[model samples]
Target: MMASPYLQCDSEQKLQCHWGLLLPPGCVVIQTSSSLTKMGCGSSIPKNCKVGGKGRKRHSIIEEVAVFVPTIRIPVDSDVVHPLRGLVSKELVDRLSKLRAHVVSLSEEIFLLTESRLEASVEFRWKTLDDDQECCVSSAWYEVLSVVHMLAMLALFEANLMLIPKDGQVGGERKVSEDAKKDVVDSLLKASGCLDYSVHHILVQIPAQVKKSFPCYLQEGMLEAISIQALAQCVEIQLGLASECEKATLSVKRRLACELVTYFSQAHYCLSGCDTSDSYGKKLLLFLKWKCMEAKAVAYYYHGLVLDKGAEASNHISAVCCLSAAEDLVTDSKRACLSFCLASPITRVPPPWGIMKNMHKKIPDAAYRKFQMYGYLFEQDKNSAHQSLPDLPEFALSLKPEGYELPSTDSIWDNVDSQPQIQSLKEHLNDEEDEVETK
Candidate 1:
């Protein structure tokens, strides 16, 4: 058996070559051109028909079989094999040996553990936490393990790139090298695998910080970007070939909905910031106005909060506009579902002053429910404008549970429309009528 040139042979010779086995004799060759005449004798012939393995016939069936074989056997001399590549060369082998030594000396497991814990600390804002609070060191450890796994997968991917060949061409083989890595990523995501590595040496593992950094780094952003890229590439690959499912899944429906809600809230928050009469609020308000559109609920909610907080507070027009936009977006089933799922900073309702001013006539019911949702805010501590609204025209007092009770003279519900009634002296009339009926 011939030894590979890339491999060390059993013999004393450090270098070996396997050209004979690599491209054996009697191997047929065939070629086709863009514009061609009747190519001669496009048919099969005996193996021994020609001196150079290819028959005298211009085209042969055996040659076609050799060309069309599904198997790809990349030769050691291929570009992908090694940098200088006659085989795995002395330089590569030596380099690989050194790398192994270094890896062994440093210990990837320990390095990963230490690095991940430090990162997690930074991510979780552990340094800011009270020392008495027990830090979630486990998440930090897991993050470390996740990073290690990512590294291992990448290393294996590079290894496979050198080992696997898809077809005869060096290009084809190189293309498939990435497939292994993609598969590994896909597998990890599908499984939602957890890691056990740690970076406990660094900052505290605060929950909120940990949650934010974990996904953006570990897998979420990459997955999202890749998914979008795949959708685009697939469309370009086969023009007019999109299936119904693909079209729908890759559509902008969900994104549009999200953006619509996002902008309205930004507008509201921006306006509220302006009302604060402070540099911070003004700067934030102006920034938001420039950066965001008036289409998101979050913007509206935040603006309302800031406005209500500010000294020169009421921008009723802008506030109402923002709230209106937010309502429009969230009225839909999809947006409504998202509104429920995703918690926002400004979604908290403020205490009612007189009436819920931003409550739309069209969506009175939802507005009322929203008002009721934040009803507790009034109970916190209130006496005048900040107090719970009196049962006004919009919110009828008659419908309330306490409606049966008589109102005080100062109350709006007090009886000011009618005069006092007088009792009748009808005892003689009642007796005369009773006597006539009896007779």
Candidate 2:
């Protein structure tokens, strides 16, 4: 991958964006957009095929991870291969248990042991989402944990995408196996837990002086953008499960849809308040826009279904408007999705999986069927079709951030702490530090 301009801003405080794959201590990842056009579920949407709303399709989406390169006080000087982040993005399903163990080992034994949070004096730089041009720099070790956890979540997300069977048929969406659905759910929950740990356990502890240097991604709001969106996506998959069940009720479907809306809108609300000056942040916000609209559409469509059960003519009119709004939102969301994919560092939308895999086809068909049934409203102009639909009723959140805690500091630190040692900064930099000269 080509290097970023920010990589040169401070030669010693370098960065790399590759997910830390068996990362060496002295070097960091720069913002390199590894081409992802053909990888996992992140590939382009199939044509002419009706989609299941399993995934909100995108043309392309950028992925990022980071490593810091500097000659300053080193936080992690030992070679650390993060288990989750180190696992090949694909072929990781079998390794998840081991991956979890590694997460604790690396976090407590290696990462926390560095105590970069309290003692590091050198600047550490890391790239943020979606953008390769800018990076966040800090000396605090917690920033490393926050970013590493987020990056690991992305690594696991790919494994979930890979577990989903391919959708190649032109006429019908394939049935997702229960095993696949369970795996997806389990993986998503783990991913959410990773971010949960970062936001609550790691990011919260950053010293006040360190907080001011944070990028929007490191801030609570944008981190929520990542955290809650994972939950929303998880709920989207569950909604698909409900749709597949012959016994599931409209209320069940409606509840899931409402929950999806709440989760995505919560993420969007958090994203909107943060700075998006970077290219990655801008695309992320746009993608969240698409997600919010899609969830709203799904909720309205199901809500309209339940409302239509009532005998009142007013109920029928409102149902008509809800369906109308659903259709509009679907259209708007598609446009917004396109905008996200077309933004800088282009990416393809993953193939549809879950209910959304079929959602694209289902919504339009349902809306059309509902519209015909409610035709009399429009025929007599009972209410203007242009009138806004009712806002979605609020629902209690169905998903919560998986609880997470950093592993306790490794016993290795006990030995190191007992012995006192002194080393000159000059000697540390000259002998141990990987000092990079810009020239």
Candidate 3:
């Protein structure tokens, strides 16, 4: 018989059993023939455990084992750089460059169109025209005027675009390259040329056409309105260009100043001869009239500035006269427009339509302020010039406001060299007048 390893024994017997030293107190261990068994000490024994029986169950011992897994980490590069690195792509830059080029090309095309129209108008003549022929000639003239106006606007737009700063420019504070400044000045000069072309090529022909056709072209005020408007625009553009380029030559500035005076005088005369009875035509005429007055005031102000910069004491006095005349014109135009508006039936309505609503209300005040500033500068120039030439006679420098009047059409045309055909037309008109006198 095999002895149980868990059996409790006396101190003398405990010394005989070698396995007894490994057991805890009050614990019973079961030993099998094949392997060693351990059972916990408790009040009730498990059903799987048998005590000294013939059918003793064999107990098996299972050992626990631990295994380790090797872990591998691959090192990654964190300093990779992008190719573009937040910069604009070459493709996008090329597209923007192309867009600017396209705008320039378009402006040139419009300029050419205006020149062609002006040529056509200059070549045209009136010779016993029928109703259809008259209409055709009138249409052609209107087309020329439209092209001129369009060219002027496009040139002005191009000039403005050139003035705009590129990206990274600090609110136009960044110093532009000298070439860029010259380019802006050139653009403005080109715009001035376009305006001058309209006044000289188109507006001057109106009187000749009126004389040739008599009552046919002068029925409505549209042609005259357009002519005056063109003249006003020409004066405005010249003044703007002169002001923009401070380093411009004295001769160039003087020419522009004289041209301004001539154009405004021409516009005033043309408007005076216009028929303003047609409601639609009157609206356009009124708008053109007020704009012409405003532009004339500004032109005079700029002319005064130019004159004030001149070497002559006479120029300074002339500058003051111009400034004074500008002020008077602005005030008179404003009062006239206000009175006209008040007397019109459109004022009684909730909102006036047509020309009444579309009138340039701010022109008067703007012109007034501009002239006032120029007037102060003119006074300073006059004082400086007077001090420099203390011996100069006052009567020699004095400008009579009444003496300033619109020159004759022939005289105005003569001042600026006209085309050969235009000169021939003037001669023909003179011959007709001579024949009428003979009759």
Displacement of the residue 306 alpha carbon in candidate 1, Å: 1.7
Writing each residue's lDDT as its tens digit, candidate 3 over 1-439 gives 2222222223324322322211111101112212212211111223454433346453331211000000101111111112111222233223323322322222110111112232232121121111112212332343333333433333333333333343423222323344544444443344344445545554554556543543322332333334334443434444445545668764554455445445445545655665555443354444445545654555555555566677765665666565666667566666645543443222211121111122234334444554564556556665554323111111111111111111112121222222222225775577567657755
lDDT of 2 at 402: 62
Off by over 4 Å in 3: 1-221, 249-254, 271-274, 306-318, 333-439
Worst 10 residues of 1 by lDDT: 66-75
Can you list the residue pairs that collide in candidate 3? Answer: none
RMSD to native for every prediction?
39.7, 12.4, 45.7
TM-score of each candidate?
Answer: 0.19, 0.66, 0.29
Q: Give the TM-score of candidate 3.
A: 0.29
TM-score of 2: 0.66
Q: Pick the candidate with the highest TM-score.
A: 2
Stretches of model 2 off by over 4 angstroms after superposition: 1-118, 122-140, 143-147, 163-176, 349-352, 377-388, 422-439
lDDT of 2 by residue, 1-439 (tens): 2221112322322222222322223111212122122223224223432122334353332432110100001112222212122222222312222322333222211232243332343233333322222333434354355444544444344434444335533333345567655655555565577667676766665676777776555666766677777788778878988988989999999999999988877878986677877664786677778778888888998998898899976678778788878888888888887787677655454455565566677778877887788778766764564345777777788788666544333233344342323446774465343333321
Model 1 ranges off by over 4 Å:
1-83, 86-91, 94-295, 309-314, 332-439
Model 2 worst lDDT run, 10 consecutive residues: 65-74
Query: Residue 233 of model 3: what lDDT?
Result: 41
